[model samples]
Target: MSNIQQLPSRQVSNRGMEGGRRSLCRFLMPLSFPWVLLWVLALGGLVLMPGAVLAEVPNAVPPEGTYEGEHVEQPIEFPHDTHADVNKINCMYCHTYARRSPVAGIPPTSKCMGCHSIIATDKPRIKQLTEYWDKRQPPPWKKVHDVPDFVHFTHEKHLKRFVFDNEGMDVENVAEVCAFCHGEVKKMTVANKVKPLTMGFCRRCHEANDGPFDCWKCHK
Candidate 1:
């Protein structure tokens, strides 16, 4: 007489189902604990310190170091201080293509005339500009911040990063961002290359600001 006890079919089915549930729980246990802990901590943080969670990440500090650039003579000495500092004009008002194009394009004669024709027609600088306008000739503005041919800089992209995409930054104060490389144009008569704009200078800034490490980003 075999002594082995046979379970009823119904009881066997229930036991098998319970064993399957135990197997499933064992498989999921490892993954579930960490995820559940993460959720709990995240919820706790949101409830206890909502401001820290919601606050915008502050922008990186601006780069430093200065260079004594040679004076660049332009056809007409543009009064940057009068326009940018005194009048509180936005940098993009004149450098209109900065937000859309690669270069912060030199303002056309028409743009100068739009203001000089009515604002300060008697000023010698304005008179010189008027002469150029009369002759329908561009003033052959010399670039003050020219980079090396190997450098691949785009004003539009820089502007988009430091101005447009930055949270808690106001567009009206775009000159502050412009000052990163161009220096304080609001204090000068003409733009000068105050920042070194050297490879090391740029690399240091990139490292500080979480910019790309790839050399191809800036070098052609």
Candidate 2:
């Protein structure tokens, strides 16, 4: 009688453990197999694609070496903070061509010396600007702020459509507009790409304001 009772209890215990093990395996098999596949796919992706799977893998170009884009830098660092921030000058005063022209003309040294001739003669920065004028050569200020050659952008149309002589508002005038695209000049000693000036970047703003974003608008 004791053996019979024990036999029934032992059978139940064995079945219960087997069920538990199967349940655990059921949970683990799917989870474990997928994990291995994930590692494989991740390895494959790195070897086959864009991120850090094979971090040591060299890029199409070497990661550490000199690279030169088309854009060039100015000879002297012209701080926008001093002129725009301190002097409260108009933007059109220098980039005087913006109102009706396709090209926003760089200020000739003569234009600069017209003021620097009196205000700060001793600064080596001003001295160079003066030298440019005396030589009849405008400072060979490189065009730092530019879009792709494919894009035919114009200061004339943008100002006519959106910006103008609204003096009180800081960002509405040409000087302010310069700050918008070029960034706060008074602060920059050397003009740099403050804006990424990419196609997507241009398109985002164009769509927002219903501005003309056609590739033809910039690329001539």
Candidate 3:
């Protein structure tokens, strides 16, 4: 009878060991090769998805290349630095047609007199401007950034894409967009063509920004 009781105890211990082994196998089953591989692929997809999304998003990367253009002389030696940088005047405030027209038209004589009629009347440049205003004549402001006649470029479309329609761009920083082709005017008293506005220069920028490549897109 004692032998029989010892046999029952041994059987009970064996059953418990078998149950523990089954529980351990159940816990480790999910970590098997196929399941682990699926998890790894899922994690890799998560890691790479953001990069793909970001690549598709547009950004303001200025064009490259420079040219030493001749110093253009204007009727009144207007200080662009003084108005744009020091006084913090917006470029659009003076060149208002840039947002709606093909060309960024020069500001009228009235626009100049609107401010200089009172402010800084004593300065020599201001005095010169006053003389023009008194004579009721517009200062013959020469164009610094003139593109080829064959090129069908529009300031309105470009500004809309880069400034108004751009997701994160601010209207206050429009000078940066202007600098892409016009150079940094805020630092210069007189505007100069510091960029190589050639076909290659334009093509490189278009390629970089994923712009339209069709010939008629730019050519008339």
Candidate 4:
């Protein structure tokens, strides 16, 4: 009788342990389902569509600058190579303020229409420029190069110091002066930032050219 009772007690305990294990499995299944599904999807994507998965990767590194190496949507697709290199049009012809002021201002729509009105009159891009001119609205030109707000870099000073005073240098065109900082714009279909334009880059150029190194020289 005693042996029989002990056997029954062991059977009940074993059943209780089995029941607890089943409860634990039920509780954990819902919690782990989403993670398991995600891993399965990722693995499936890698096996089935590797190129698509790689192309749509969320954490891919972005290219430097706001406009550099980017196909920026614009009101007009102005070809720099055609204007600056082919036609031999000067950079100052459009950006007139570069000689006198800190900013290299964008040409007004009228200035664009001045040439497009006669040249390339049949082209669709010229037609777009004409429409903007007729409406008297400025083309929403996005700036390619951006300097820090705190740093005060004037185009006038650099022009005076480097281009005019240094007679021995081969800097004849205003475009060459611009090419010192901005890369060869005459060759590009769209202007892009080639230089990193950081403080370190500026300091290295200043030190090489014997420009001012004082903290306030640029920072102010």
Q: List where candidate 2 sits over 4 angstroms from the true fold.
A: 1-72, 165-173
Instruction: Order the candidate numbers by TM-score, best to worst.
Output: 1, 3, 4, 2
Model 2 lDDT at residue 5: 24
What is the C-alpha lDDT profile of model 4 across 52-144, one tens digit per residue?
Answer: 221221211212221234556566777899998888888888988877899888987778878787888999878877887888888787777
TM-score for predicted model 1 compared with the true structure: 0.73
Predicted candidate 3, C-alpha RMSD: 25.5
Task: State which candidate, 2 or 4, has the greater lDDT.
Answer: 4
After superposition, the stretches of candidate 4 with alpha carbons farther than 4 Å from their true spots are: 1-69, 168-172
TM-score of 2: 0.60
Q: Ten consecutive residues with minimal summed lDDT in candidate 2?
A: 57-66
Candidate with better TM-score, 2 vs 4: 4
Write the residue-wise lDDT of candidate 2 on 13-120 in tens digits.
234445766886675566577777886787697788842221221111111111123435677667666776577667677778988898888787767878888988
- Candidate 1 lDDT score at position 86: 95
Ten consecutive residues with minimal summed lDDT in candidate 1? Answer: 1-10
**lDDT of every predicted structure (CA atoms):** 0.78, 0.59, 0.78, 0.66
Off by over 4 Å in 3: 1-58
- Alpha-carbon RMSD, candidate 2: 23.6
